[model samples]
Target: MKQIIKIIGNPKIFVYTLIWLMVLVVLGTLAQRDIGLYASQQKYFSANITWLGNIIPAPGGRITMVVILVNLTFMVLFKHNLWKIKKIGVLIMHIGGLLLLIGGGLTAIFSSEGNMVIEEGAQSNYVDDYHNMELAVINTSNEALDEYTVFDQPILGKGNILSHENLNFNIEIMSYLKNCEPLKRTAPAGIQYRGMLKNFMLSELKPEKENSRNRPGITYRITNSGSSIDGIYGIFFGQSVSQTAVINNQNYEFIIRKKRTYLPFAIELLDFKKVLHAGTGIAKSYSSEVNLIENGIPRRVLIEMNEPLRHKGYTFFQASFIEGLEGETTVLAAVKNYGRLFPYISSIIMSIGLLLHLLSSLPKLLRKIPGVSPS
Candidate 1:
C-alpha cells in the first residue's frame, strides 16, 4: 500500500497523466470529423474505455481523469509536508483543483440537457434528448393521464430479455439498429408476426453526422402476452403511430423515440419573433415569448439567444427556429446542471490560494534584498 501511494502521488506521475490527457483530447477532436461530435464524445471521452475502430481498447477521457484525481487525492492524504503552515497556500491550491475535478465528475454524471421544440400557440412539458433513444411503453387506458414505463438505451441490446412487474409479458429484443427505416411490404406477414412488422420491414441505415437526425428502430418478440397479440413487433422513431397492445385488459402503446424527459413545468410559445440582418435574409436576433406554467399558474418570460430563463434549476435558452406552413417554431435548449456553480467557486478558491501564496512568500524575498530585517 505504501509503495502504491509513493508511485501514485509522485509529481512525475502527475506530469505524465497531463500528457496522456492531452493525447486523448487530440484523439477525440480528430475522431469528431468522422463520427460527429456527440458520438466521438461518447466513445472516446465519456466512456471508461474507448475501442479503436471498434477493436483495440484503450483508457478513455473519463478513466484518465479518474487517474489524475486519484493521484491528487493520494498527494493530499499521504504527504505530510503539505500540512505545514508554510505550505498552506499550496495546499489550498491543490484543494481547489481537487474540488474542480470533483465538480466535473458530478456534471458528467448528473447533468441533463435536451431540446424542447414548441410550435406557436402550443404547450409542451417534455424535452427530447439530442442523442439518446428509449423504448417507451405507455399505458393509455386513462383518458386524463397516461403512465409511462421507459426502457432506456443501455438495456435495449439485442437478445436481451426485458420484463417488469408492471408488464404482463416479456419482451425479447431481436434486432436493435442505431439508425433505420421502415419499408412497406407487399405480402402479408405470417401468424407469428404482429404490429408494424405485419405491414413493413425495417431497413438498416447509416447514422447521420448530426446525432439528432438518426432514426433508430427495434424489432422484438412478445412472450407470455396471454392473447393472440403475443408475437413479433417493430417500432421506429417518428412513426406517427405506436404499436398497440392489450395487456391485462389495459391498452398499451410501444414506441421508440428520442428519450423524453417530462418537465415539472410546461412551456407555451406565445410568440416567436426574429429580426433579419441588414441587406440579408439571415436572422440577426430571434426570441420566444413563452408562458412557463407551473401547477396551473402561468408566468410569462422572454427567452433570447443571449438571454435565458432560469426557474427551479432548469434553464431555457432560445436555440433556433424552424419555419413551417402553420408558422414559426421555437426550439428551446433546456439544461439542468448540478455543478453549474462549481467553476465559479473553484476559481474563487484558486484566486484566494494565489493571493495567500503571494503574502506568504513576499516577506522571505524582501529579507534577501538590501537592508530588510530577517526578524
Candidate 2:
C-alpha cells in the first residue's frame, strides 16, 4: 500500500495521466467513425478497460480518471502541506477540482435522463429510457388499476430463466435479439405459439445508429404453468399487442418495451406552441404549456427550450414536437440529477481560488516592476 501510494503521489504521474486522457479523447473520437458514438464511448470512455479485438487490453477513461483523482488528492493533502498559510489559494483550487470530480461521480451513478411524450390534452407520468429494454408483465385483471411488474435488461439476456414471486409461472428464454425484424409466417406454427407469434416470425436485423430505434424481440417458453396457459411466448418492441397468459385466474400480458421510470407527479400537455423561422419550415422556438399535476393538485407551467420547469430534482425541457393527424405530440426531455448544481458551484470555487492566488502573488509581481512599489 505504501509503494502504491508513493507511485500515485509522484507529480510525474499527474502529468502522465493528463497526457493519457488527451490520447483517449482523440482515439475515442476517431473510433466513433467506425463503431459509432455510443459504442465507442462505452468501450473507451465508460469501461475501466478497453479490449482490442478480444486480445490486447488498454486503460480506459475511467481508469485514467481514477489515477488523476488519486494523484490530485495526494498532491492536495500531503505534498502541499494542508493548512499552510501561503498555499491557501492552491489548496482551495485543488478542493474545487476534487469537488468537480466528486460531482461527476455522483452524476454518473445517480443521474436519470429520458423522454416523456404527451399528446395534446394527454397526461403521462413515466419517462422511457433511451437505450434499455424492459419486459413488462402487466396484470390487467383488476378494473380499478393494473399492476405492473417489470424485468430490466440485465435479467432479459439470452438463455436466462425469469421467475418472479409475483408471477406464477417461469419464463425460459430461448432467444433475445437486440435488433429484430417481424415478417408474415408462410406456414402455421404449433399450438404452443400464440398471438402475434403465430402469424409473424421475428428475425435478427442490423442494429440502428440510434439505439432507441433498434426493435428488440424475445422468444421464451413458459414453464411451471398449466397446459392451457403454458406455451411459447414472443414479444417485441413497438408491438401493438402482447402475449396474454392466464395465471391464478388473472389475465397478464407480457410485452417488451423501453424501460420506464415512473415519477411521483404527472405532466398533462395543454397546448404546444411553435414559431417558424421567417419563410422557412424550421422552428425558431417551440414550447409546451403543461399542467404539472402533483398530489391531486394541478399547476400550470410553460416548458420551453431555454426556460425549463424544475420540480423536486427533476427538470423538464421542451425537446421536440411531432405533428399528427389527431393532435400535436410534445416530447419533453426529463432529467433527474443529484449533481446538477455541482458544475456551477465548482466553477465559482475555482474562480475564487484563481483570483485569490493571483492577488496573493500581486506583491511579488509589483516588486519585479522597478517603478511600482508595494504599499
Candidate 3:
C-alpha cells in the first residue's frame, strides 16, 4: 500500500502523466481529420479505452485526466508541505487546479447540448438532440390534444420488442438503418410496406463521417392479440408520412425523429436577418429576433453570433438559418451546463497564485544577478 502511495505521490510521475496527456491531445487532433470531430471525440476523449486501427490499445483522454487529477490531489495533501508560509502560493495553485478538475468532471457528466429550430411566425418550446433519435407513438384521437409515448434510441434494433402497460399493442422492430435513401418502388418486392413507404423503398446507405448528417430509418410491425395490424410500417426523419394504426379502438400515429427535450418556456421567432459580405457569398452576420414566452408573459430578445441569451440555467446561441417553402427558419444551439462558471473562477484563482509565487521568488532571482540588488 505504501509503495503504491509513494509512487503516486512522486512529482516525476505527475510530470510523466502531463507528457502523456499532451501526446493524447496531439493524437486526438490528428484523428479528427479521418474520423471527424464527433467520432474522434467519442473514441479518443470521452471513452475509457481506445484502440488504434482496432488493435493497439491506448489510454483515453478521460482516464488520463482522471489519473492526473488523482496524482495532483495526492501531491498536494500528502507530499507537499502546504502549511508552510513559503508554500502558500503553491497551495493556492493546487487548490485552483483541483477546482478546475472538479468543474471539468461536473461539466462532462451534467451538461446537456441540443438545438432548437423555429420557423418565422412559429413558436417552439422543444429542442432536438443533434445525434440521438427516438421512436414516437402519438395518440391523435382527439383533435384538441396529442399524447406522445417516446422510446429513446437505446432499445431500437432488429428483433427487439417494446410494449407498455397502457398500450394494448406490441411494437416489433423489423429493421433499422443509420443512413438510408428513399427509392421508387419497383418489382421483386418481398413484403409490402404500408402508407408512404408503399410507393418507395428504403435503401440502406453508408453512414456519413459526420453523424449529424445521417438520417435514420426504421421499419416496425404493430401486433395486437397475436395478430399483425399494421404490416411493416416504415418511418424516417424528414419524411411526410401520415399513417395511423387502431389499437384498443384508439388511433395512434407512429414516426421516428430526433429526440426532443421540452423547455419551460417557448420561443416565437419574429424575424431572422442575414447579411452577406460585399461581392462575396460569405455571411457577415446573422441574427434572430424572438419573443420568449413563459407563464403568460412574453419578452422580446435578440440573439446574435457571439451574444447569447442566458435564461434559467440554459444558454441559447444563434447557430444557423434554414430556408423553407413557407419562410426562413432560425436554428439556436442550446446548452445547459451546471459548471459554466468554474473555468472562470479557477482561472482567477490560478492567476492570483502565479502572481504571488512570482513576487515571493523575486528576491532570490535578484540575488543571482551581480548588478541587481534587493531592497
Q: What TM-score, over all chains together, does every model reach?
A: 0.90, 0.93, 0.90
The CA lDDT at 364 in model 1 is: 93
Candidate 3 structure quality by residue, lDDT tens digits, 131-178? 889998898888999988888998998999989875778889998999
Residue 304 C-alpha lDDT in model 3? 98
Query: How many clashing residue pairs appear in each of the predictions shown?
Result: 0, 0, 0
lDDT score, candidate 1? 0.90
Error of 3 at 246 (Å): 2.5
Which 10-residue span in candidate 3 carries the lowest summed lDDT? 187-196
Q: State residue 236's C-alpha deviation in candidate 3, in Å.
A: 2.0
List ranges where model 3 is wrong by over 4 Å.
Answer: 1-3, 184-188, 191-201, 224-226, 278-282
Q: How much is the lDDT of residue 102 in candidate 1?
A: 90
lDDT of 3 at 213: 87
lDDT (10s digit) by residue, model 2, range 178-266: 89988989998989887677888899998775666789999988888765767777888888766787776989888898889999999
Superposition-based RMSD of candidate 2 using all C-alpha atoms, in angstroms: 2.1
